[model samples]
Target: MKLQCEVEVINRMLPTFGMRNRGKGTRAVLSVGRQEGKRGAIYLMICTLKDKAGSRYKLENNIEQLFTKFLGEGKATIRLKEPALDICLSKAEMCSLKNFVSIVGLANKGSDAGTPLLSQLIPAKTSEIEKPRAKMFITSKKDYPITKNFPYSLEQLQVSYCKLARIDMRMLCLKKLQKLDLSNNHIKKLPKTIGDLICLQELILSHNYLESFEVALCNSTLSNSLKLLDLSENKIKALPVQICNFKELISLKIDENDLLQLPFTIGRLSKLRLISAAKNKLSCLPSTFKMLRLEKVDLFGNPFIQASPMVPDIQLKIPQTLLETAAREVARYRIPYGPQLIPATLCQDLSMAKTCDCGLSCLNSFIQIVVAMNLHQVSQTVVLVDTMGGTDAPIICYFCSLTCYSHFLDKYLQSIRD
Candidate 1:
């Protein structure tokens, strides 16, 4: 999902696989069930099975030209270029499908062929059967409700593209849940009990209305195991310095927000491998941002001045493939650029120069008159953050003097709070 693609393709390939056909795709289900070990199941459904006539015939054997691997599932993350097929199957039914072979009339609509297949593969009564602990839980639909009761044994739960706003705090009962996705929702805040799910490793809350973090999320127990946190496409203004609580966080995405600045405490997350903070109002990053060995760092949309320390060696663009840990980079990537130049000086080019929050652009730099310049007790400063290195990070100030920087700082904070 990282590499943007059209949902129109899903519509084209699955014009019939709508809500009405959710659990009613009996023939389509059997066709997929018969090809348990055989690969290209998704490609077959998308490309080969164009219509009912296409799906009725058995899948071709010459699949050398066609290819798709069943990458291990985790939270049902569908990376770009990877085809995904949806189905609903109980654990027992899944166990029985391994030996199922496709029969002549089994996939025919309105035929009795499916009765024998189901009777043989699935037990009639699941009442007395002992259900296995849940490993993967997936439900994708718009306006889907989040139930209060969920199995504690679940390792992955994907409730993406739903209209859920508030998740029941009882979900913290899942002591073993590893991956949780509540993306594409109207959620404003997370439950305080979310901190109790210490086993959560990858949490995706992207495309929501979250303006800030839950106080309980700063707990060390949850931070110790939470590796990936995606908070992109939200209303977040700035991340608290307490976010450094995620001691094991490897990737952090706060893109598409109203963020004016990032807390210096982020440097405490030594395990952080990537930072996606594009499309924010940030003028500069924290001093310690350049100290880490990040695989990817995105700050393309920020109005960074020349004093910012972030080097331009890394590309701001997301790789065509998945992240390195999730993809194979077969070739070198040419990261795209989006105007990585500092604003012009007022004395030089007014057209390109950025005015200070105080409405004055520093045109001259000479002597220092602290008291006269409102610098008696001022610590805040402003300057153009450097996009390609050469920033004094220990205390990054984008201004030529401290007074203007301090003035802007107070205004920026107040704006975000409102």
Candidate 2:
């Protein structure tokens, strides 16, 4: 809603509070607009010069304080701050935190321009005082409202570290959007509708609770123009082979995930220039990795018992690329040596208990069924499965193995054909 900080520099994004000429002790104003046309309140700060020898670095310290304060406020005109970060800060830092914006319930007034903040510049209501004040509010930046006009001609939308968990499809219908960043949110899943952004080029959904990539359901255009895809620091365990469809990808980041493997077609990304799979559980790379047109790669902190000792030697250097390239040429015609394979019989330990006649109970992973189905119904149909009423009419069959389930399901489908 509002912020106070010491100004160390005069810049366009940050106003000098008309005190840039005042030098060292002047406060700076950072006024961010919500809508494209409207102006918002400015962040004012009183600069204190403890040591003026070098204060530019100290200006960044103010930015840090600004960040810490927004996170401290439980709610604000905009929501920011990760709750997990609070654990590491000391008591005094938390104590120094204060939310600048305020939230006022105005049922009679419109929700958008309903509550105008009262500060030094503007001290009255819109009806009583017609002066133009900054359109600002104190609300959860995480829960920041998305108006229909917010995405008008918008090309990039970044909500990183905003504590946001989901994309508002209504606001995401913008036709011009090229990039979307939702990093550092606690989001558990991505809306398949994200594929609807026909012009999207970059998708940064890093550092969240996402466990897997829903490749088949996403839109076709998403992969057509995408160049940078950062899914690093998520809970991804395995990626679908369809990810190779992102032929335009220049960089891919899947680091710090639970991933033990990548699709064999990963190397099919002919345009991929860089890939970072650091801090994952990968034991070996895909056999197709030899086909990658990569310029750089990072694969540190993995378990590769039978892997080539060259793993530790996989440093970022031109010579290493040449060496790997030469080796890749030799291995191109040979069978891929990476990505360990497990026999079907070894899949017995895992099972998915179910209530349907589709014989899905013995399946090992949802992706298996997702691959069979169109892949867009999981989120929509989960509720129906809970509310279905016809289950009382049947005698259920439980299969001991995936093969048995597949056999039964196939037989049942064939029987229906008769």
Candidate 3:
């Protein structure tokens, strides 16, 4: 197999000395095949970018061991014996890397298994066409590449200070993009097409004019890949309840917005660790605020309600409707009911099912109450919620049944009295 990738020849058995300390590799091509006219002998050849007569080694008895060490995405190190050399391959396409490694591994076994088909030894045409046209594109001078040579293979693209009122359609076509920064623009709305960037991990829309976090974005493939989202300095009044779909989100910054309250389901984001929502107009947190295990939480400058005496208002409708009972069962057991199995309205209602303190799911028939929560209990590093050195904030709670409410009332009252 022939693959074009970076190559590094390092002998760790040799002492670290002059000229070896740089530890950088060169762009090269690796080839694995049988030597011409040499029956039953496999050869591994590496050609540097500038040389054609590359170093060749006979695989029979020349290799003591062969194994692969993953460095990171798109990079790997192959260790070979006898010469005690490590061949590091960086910036290699994943498909090419896998094929190259497999061929060399089979050759090292010293059998006819080393003889890969003749066609398999040739580089794939698709790999040549998929070669990156560009890896990164950044601009802050308002010189956007809207019509010309837009980097199609870009993994990172920053188009800040461009005054772009809408997302560029060309950018959504970059399926390999990992980070997209459109900060300091005038964008008012995000295109649902933004979700086409299935590989995107960081999305920065700070200093924009956005008014709402669309549900389409939350339901997209981004729910799986997005790790960091910065929506700071926007005019958003409320985030969609579906924001909980960002299961992989780690850091969320919504500072200087007009948010009233976060989604009650946000606690479902099990990977979330950091949050910055300072200077918002939030009065109370969702009931599930205490469910988070956060590392850092910043709520300074927000108007959080002071702690009040616990009040229980038990309001439950007994003998729930057949639909409500079925919905609760589906939600509690996660029966995988979707729009295809039921009406769209019922599916929507089921998606919004509430969870009681007792861990059971409920719909419209539940008792509700309000209580104070100390922010310190939810996070390790917390900024004060108000100027009065207060950290207590009100959180709404729901109970699926009177039995669940009765069971929690004693512990809840005793804790609040403390």
Candidate 4:
């Protein structure tokens, strides 16, 4: 009888199981019957119970089962108020309605969904329900001492945005912590015992007032596990040479700092891929920097001077020889009160001069006479002249008799031409 009833219920629910109009309270029943001479009837219902009392009782029993299996023998309440049978399952003399719906579409014709349902139905094993891990937060007010005694057993800790004046992290005993974030804080220094976090993988100390890096971080164990480290926006001028000891470090950011130079040990970071040292006071790079297997480098705002022993072609094209020769000639013959004379060694030309003489006779006679004769030589009576064929040739002078003769020749030539 129970088998017949289960078959009938399954058939009824099968056609409408996947249908939209089957309604929420529709039940899918599975019943088993005695093969020979069994007396009692058994029925199994698998669906939501509309009766509040019956639904409550089933929920409470399931909760009890869950606690006993997962929480190590715990007690639970069981009571139900209403019943508008949705899905039913029957086996021998047992019958129960299941409220939870499996998202995977029901397969009445096969046993594909049964294994998954049974697995989920079995409560978690006792060994699986371990104590929950704790969490840590930085809630200290500004200017307060950052206490190290955290309240929770944390696997990860985030202490950002806490305006802490001083950090005493030595008191922290977080052995299980795997990650720590101290970004955007007012931390000036890290405790020397920071290496205590043997299990830590990622540590972020960006945007802080750290004037120097923690020396304790040089520990080989910590460096091996530390994969990412960010120390950007700080007052750090130089990184410790031990930084290259981080054999496992992949990414490092030290941007917006006062770094003047990087240690050559940077080449030891064989696994380093990304590095940022922008906005620094770096004037030159280390030769070992070529050893870096970098994809990109930001070297802006650095003073670079490209120098070579050989003069450039552009400088060779300039008329430097002519300029030097003219400068030298002018310097050798210091002509005063006429075409303001420039020294030969000077690279530029002179334009004007300030006369010291005040009298008109001094200006007209002396200045004019000097200007007309091009008398560059200063002597007692007669000015000397360079009568040499070439402009740069030696200077020479003739007596007053020769000067009169030169005047006679100039007059004779002019008369003949007219």
Question: Which one wins on TM-score?
Answer: 3
- By TM-score, the better pick of 3 and 4 is 3
> What TM-score, computed on C-alpha atoms, does each candidate reach?
0.45, 0.41, 0.67, 0.40
Q: How accurate is candidate 2 locally (lDDT)?
A: 0.48
Best-to-worst lDDT order: 3, 1, 2, 4
**Model 1 alpha-carbon drift over 4 Å, by segment:** 1-148, 308-418
Give the lDDT of residue 243 in candidate 3: 92
Runs with alpha carbons beyond 4 Å of true place in candidate 4:
1-131, 134-152, 168-171, 303-418
Candidate with more favorable, higher lDDT: 1 or 4: 1
**Whole-structure CA lDDT of model 3:** 0.79
> How far off is residue 341 in model 2, in Å?
30
The candidate with the higher TM-score, 1 or 4, is 1
lDDT of 4 by residue, 346-405 (tens): 322322111112211101111111101111221122211222311111111111222333
Residue-level error in angstroms, candidate 2, position 27: 34
Query: Using alpha carbons, what is the TM-score of model 2?
Result: 0.41
- The TM-score that candidate 1 achieves is 0.45
lDDT of the candidates, in the order given = 0.49, 0.48, 0.79, 0.44
Candidate achieving higher TM-score, 1 or 2? 1
Tens-digit per-residue lDDT, 225-300, candidate 1: 9999999999998777678888889889998999988875665678887777778887655534534556656656
- Per-residue CA lDDT of model 3 for 1-418, tens digit only, reads 6877777788876675444634887767777776767767777777763555567766666665544566335577767665777777888777768777777777777756546453323332433324455555455554666558665568888888878899888889888889999999899999998988999999999999999988999999999999999999999999988999999999999999999998878888888999999999988788777889999999888877653335666666677888778878888787987778889998889878888888888888888777787888989988887787877777888888878877777786787599
